[model samples]
Target: MRRLAAGVLSLAVAGILLAGCSPAPASDDSPLSAASPAPSRSTVSAGDPDLPAMPPTPAPSAVVDDAAADDAGERLRALVGDAGRPAEVALLGDSFAAGEGAGSYQPVRGVADSLCHRSADALLADAAGTPPSPPGTAILHNLACSRARMSSVTAAQAVEGHGPEGVPAQLEQLAGIRPDLVLLSIGGNDLGFAGLLQACVVDTEPCGQDPALRETTRQQLLQLQAPLTDVYRTLGAATPAPVLVLPYPRLFDAGAEDCGRLSSTELAFGLEITDALNSTIERSVQAANLPNVRYVNALEDSFAGRGACSPDPLVNTARFGPLLNAATSVPASQEVLHPTQEGYRVLTRDLLRWLEENPM
Candidate 1:
């Protein structure tokens, strides 16, 4: 996920940008509290319980098996270090991993709870119920920034070598540490797809489903493939551990029509953009197939038919409180289209299962 805050907001929340890695702040506005500002451990369990349960435990899912589970276990064992002590695992991505909007003490297994912007740490904490520590190592790093794009990874010092412009540098750094694994979440910025979709809604005919808009969506998606490929290729060569590239969560509050404020035309436009983006992701992953790279199709599972602007909503989008104004309230973090902590839980669970199935 991309960082949710820019400017002063980023500075205030920068402490929470995941553990281990830190980047120079970007010049953007303060992150709105809507971004879950700064999450610490206490906040994880402190969330709204009414939130939907993550998909049923993976053990029962036909999608995974004992072998996969074993693989995941092995991989974790290696990541943790000798005798299962906390080791080093790098989280590379935008704010989605930062657990924005979730509050302070962002938790992640094997790492201490504080303000670190790492979705992986949150995932680990959410999955394991505690942060991993020394002997028990904690080298969690979140290099993502609010406006950070694919290029950001290669630039910042915290992730300078890993920013888009620093791929070669990142590769060189990785060759030395030879990390156990990497969590890769990117691509949303490459197409600037979200802004484009919003523009389509504000400027054009929502209901018409204009061919021009569709084509624009299609072209941007096509363009992203090459850059994503570059990212995958670089990771494949640099890291021996498996690289998990999280998919973009579904966009569009499907139940948006209920709000009355968002016309069906607008809802339809949002859904159309969502569909196009997902299609692009699936196709790109299929075509690329970089070694040691796996595209975790989290978006397909989370948003599916229940997505924002979905044909059906899990909650009434028109109502206030948790489900308010699907058109506006459900962006996960301000400006950044991502899953909420409730959403990240879904990813965490899936990763656990995936790890279980595919150990190092």
Candidate 2:
């Protein structure tokens, strides 16, 4: 393991803190099936995988671009939904919102240490827990699965590997809850991006040098745009509140030496595909223009421009330091391919800020 720099970044990244608040009962007390049983999953992971520390983020500042700032503010206003009184807020998608590692709750809080990664019930509980309002003021339903796909977002899509129901079934279940606001994050599984990224790590051939494989991946990524467009339309039309679609986070670490492991070709191809997918999503959201539909700039805030090759990759694979836990008390693995818990915390904080800045 390499020696990681010990600074505010390292401390924030490695040190895990439990909130001073006590754990709430794992059940929703809201009107929308506040007592619904948790979803059943045959196989489950123990707890969230510990993430590495990150450099401290600069304080939130104004977005310089006039148009970008306007757009962001507009989106935030829309998200708050009638002064934060949205009728129903349903969370939809894959593992990002499912709280997979955190185990099921009667009312569903988020996965431990998961920031944006939350179940609908958890988000609603958080919203409700905000004082003045009890949880469940708005219906919150989570329809995300661990390894869901773009097709999964479609009405009748099926799960190929495991699980009793498909994403559409879950969505239908959410529809039953009749939410007013829907937060969605999906498509990674469909593109098989994660698997391909792992392959890129070990491939002996220079990355992106594999034109044939590159083209195949590119087309698949492009294909994902269509499903995203369709799902947005479908979900937007179903519920009264506008739908908020979130983009995937970049899975590469930035400024780390191991990043050299990824050839320029691989990095280029990864960026190209991810960007294209995001572009399509933005356009589709605009074209649809549903009354309550909106786009949450997940990629733009945390991942835009900064990819695996940027100064900071939230999901990095590069070696900054020990790459593993320094403390013998608990062994930690620095897997740069996923958001470190710290990275996710940053995302969560930003996400909340984004919501504040662009409340619907």
The alpha-carbon RMSD values of the candidates against the true structure, listed in the order shown, are 12.7, 15.0
Error of 2 at 288 (Å): 3.1
* Model 1 residue 188 distance off true place after TM-score fit, in angstroms: 1.0
Whose TM-score is greatest here? 1
Tell me the tens digit of each residue's lDDT in model 2 across 1-360.
Answer: 223333322332332111101111222210001112211111111111131212222333212233433243233335554455534555677655553323232222223432223332233333322223442243345666545555555554443223344324556666567554677766655555544544454456754455555545545544455566777788777777657787655444222224544565555444444544455566567767786778776433364334445565444433334233322211122133444433443444456566677656
What would the TM-score be for candidate 1 when compared with the true structure?
0.58
Top candidate by lDDT: 2
Model 2 scores a TM of 0.57
Off-target runs (Cα >4 Å) in candidate 2 are: 1-88, 99-140, 154-168, 253-256, 259-269, 301-336
Report the poorest 10 consecutive residues by lDDT, candidate 1. 29-38
lDDT score at residue 155, model 1, on the 0-100 scale: 47
lDDT (CA) per prediction:
0.43, 0.45
Model 1, 98-191: lDDT tens digits are: 5443334333233343223344434443423233443433454443433345664554323322334322333443445545567766655454
TM-score of each: 0.58, 0.57
